[model samples]
Target: MAELQGFVFPRTATGRSSILPAPPWHYSGDLLTIEYRTDPERVIELLPDPIEPADDPGAVALVWADWQSCSDTFDELLDPVRAQYKEVFFVVRGRYQGEHVSRCVYIWVDKDYALVRGHYQGYPKKLGSIHLTRPVAYGKAGPRLEPGGRFGATLAAYDRRLAEARFTITGTADQGGFVNSHAMLHTRFLPAIEGAQAPPSLHELVTMKTVDVDAGPVYVGDADLTLFDVPGEEFGRLAPREMIGAYYRQVGATFVGGTTVHSYDD
Candidate 1:
C-alpha cells in the first residue's frame, strides 16, 4: 500500500485544531473492508442529479462522496496497488461560505487492491449476530485512530498543533475550526476522482447534487502505513475553479479512493 499523506495545519492559539481530524469512519464502526480505485466512472455515478437553482438566491449546492478507514480489508486493497503504482494519492477539498480550500495525500505503492475486498463501504455494515456497538461522537479531542509510525507521526504532529490551538486563551477551542479543513479534504477527494475520467466542465461539477448515504456507526482499528514511505511520492495539489476543471482528467482517484462510473443523475 502507499504511505498515508495528509496536511498538518498550524497550531491555533488555543492548541486544538488539526486539518486532519479523526475521520467519521474511525468511530462509526465502519468496516475498512472494501476496495476502491481512482475510477472516474464510478465517481460520476455517486454524484446526485443537478438541481435547478431556486429562485431564492441562498440555496446551497449539493454533492456526495464515500469514506472508509484502515481495516484488514484496506490492507488487502493496498497489497496489489502497492505493486502496480509507484505512488498512491488521496486528494481532498471543501467549500464554505464563499471560499474553498483543498489538499492532496500522496503515498508510494507498487500494486493496487491486492488485499482489499470489492467496492468502498462508506457506511457501517449491519451485523446480524453482533452484540453491542459504540456510537461515540468525538469530544473536544475530535477523533482518534490507532496511530502507526510514519502516518501516525504526521497525524500526531497535526493533532498536537490542533490541540494547542484549541486550548489557546484567545481561540474558541471548538472543533468548529477544523470543520472546514476536514470538509475540504472530503470534498477535495471527490474532484480528484471526478475529473479523472472526461474531466467535468468547470461549472458542471462544482454545482451538482450530493447525497449523504446512510452510514451506520462503526469502530475502526489502526494499521501501520509508515513503512511504505516514498519521499517524492507524498504530496498534495490545490486548484481554483478555473484550474480545477483543467485537472479533471489529468489525475484520477487513488486505487483505494474508489471505482465505478457515475453521473449527477445516477
Candidate 2:
C-alpha cells in the first residue's frame, strides 16, 4: 500500500510533518500586558453574534511576549532559534450565555509555525515583527520584574508600526489582576476553495483548551499605549480611551487544542 501521513501539512511516507510537530506544544515566555477601555461600539463590531459585550463593554487587553516553545520531543529547546518567537495580541471582553469570556480580535506572531498553530486554535493570527524588553537581574536602566521596573514593547507589520506599549511596575499582583481570568472565545474559519463564490467551508465559534497551565506572578503598573492608524489595518479602531492596568509576567502553558462552541453552517 502506498500512503502519505502526518498530523500537519506536507506529509511524508515516514509520517513526518513538514511544518509542525505532534500535539502538546508547550510555551514559556515573558509578557508585557496592558489593559484599557476602548470604544464600546468598536467592541460590538469585533465580537460575533451571540457574544455581547460584558459589563465593562469597552475593556480590553493587549499583550506582547517573547516566547520559547517546543513540542513533545522538545528538540527546539536545544536549537534556540527554532523555539524563539515573539507575538502580540488584543483581547476584548464579551458575554456569552451570561458568562464572561475573552475574545482575541487581532494577533501578530513572528514565526510561520506559530501563526499556523494559532490558526488551528482559532486565533486571527498574522505574521509581523514583535519586540519587547527582556528583563534581566542586573539591568539598571529598567526592564526588571521588581518595583520601579519599566518595560516597552512594539508590534509592526509591512514596515509600519501598528501599536506599542510601556509599563512601569508598582508592585506584585495576583491572578485577579490578570486580564484573561476566564476562558477565551475564538472563531475557526476556513474559506471554501471548491467554489469561487461559496461561503466559508468551516466556520465555528470555539474555545481553546490548555493543559498544565501556569499563571505566573504578575507585576502591576501604570501603562501607556499608542495605536497607529495604519492604512490597511482596522485594529486601530479599538484605540484606548482610558488606561486600566498593566502587568509584567512569566507564563508557561501547553496547547492541547480546542472545542467548537457553535457552528455557523448549521
Candidate 3:
C-alpha cells in the first residue's frame, strides 16, 4: 500500500498557522528528504548559502506524476494541469498482509487551477479547480463512490466530516529525525471487499529519506504518530521509530543520508 498511501491526499492545504517541533530523533545522515512542491524557481531561492550540489551527489531529481497511465479514467482530466506546474513525488509503504504498496504523485499550480495526479493500484485521479485549498479533506482528495454498502455509507460520512476540517504542516525533519504535522480529517477503517476483516488496529508512519546521495548509518526516529480513527476519539497510534529501533538498532535514518524518499503504509 506504499504507492496508494502516498497518493492519499495531494494539492490540498490547510491555512492554519501552527508549528509543532520535530520530534527528537537521530539518523545517520545529515541530508533531508521532503515532499517538495513549489515553483522550481522558488526551490532555487530557498537553496542554502554557498549553494553547491553535494560532491559525487545523485542526480538533481525531478518530481513528476502521470495521470494517463492509470486504471481510473479520471486521469485524463488531471494530466493537463500536471503538464503546467510539474510536481512529482513517490512514497513506499511497507507490506500489508504480505502485499507491497507504493504511491506516486504529480502536482501543478497554474493561473486558473491546481492540478494533481495520483496513482494507486494503477487507478489514477486528477483534481482541477480555479481556487485551490490547502489541506483539502482526504475525502475530497480523489474520486468518491456512490453510497452502497455499510462501508460505503461509513466512508461517505467520513468525507463529509473531513471537508470542513483543517490541517497544517507543523514541522518537517530528516529521516533520522521526525516530522510533526497537525492534521484533522474524518478517518475510518474499511474492511477489504472480499470479506477480509479489518486489522485489529491501524497505524501510520511517514518517513522521508534519500537513497544514494548522503548515504551513512541509519537511525530511527523516537516519536510516535497518533492516528485518530474516529476524530476526537483516539483509535490507535504507531510508534515505529521506537518500536522498530527496539528490535533493530540501525534500521532508522542516519546522518549524511543518500536520497529522497517518503512512505505511508497501512
- Candidate 3 per-residue lDDT, tens place, 1-266, comes to 13222223431244112121111212221111222122233233322222322221111211121111111233323654322321222221222223332222212222122222112112122332112122222565532112110110011123322111111222222443211111101111233555555442322222233222233332222222222244532111111112211000112222121221222232
Q: For residues 60-112, could you state the per-residue lDDT of candidate 2 as single tens digits?
A: 88889899999899999998888999999988888889999988899999999
Give per-residue lDDT, candidate 1, residue 188: 18
Residue-by-residue lDDT tens digits, candidate 1, 143-240: 23222111111211211211000011111112211211232222111234456575533222222112233333222222222212223222111111
Ranking of all predicted structures according to lDDT, beginning with the best and ending with the worst? 2, 1, 3
Query: Model 2 misses residue 41 by how many Å?
Result: 0.9
Residue 22 Cα positional deviation in candidate 1, in Å, after optimal superposition: 33
Error of 3 at 190 (Å): 25
The model with the greatest TM-score is: 2
- Model 1 TM-score (2 dp): 0.21
Q: Where in model 1 is the C-alpha error above 4 Å?
A: 1-208, 220-227, 236-266
Off by over 4 Å in 2: 139-142, 176-178
What C-alpha lDDT values do all the predictions have? 0.22, 0.85, 0.22
Best by lDDT: 2
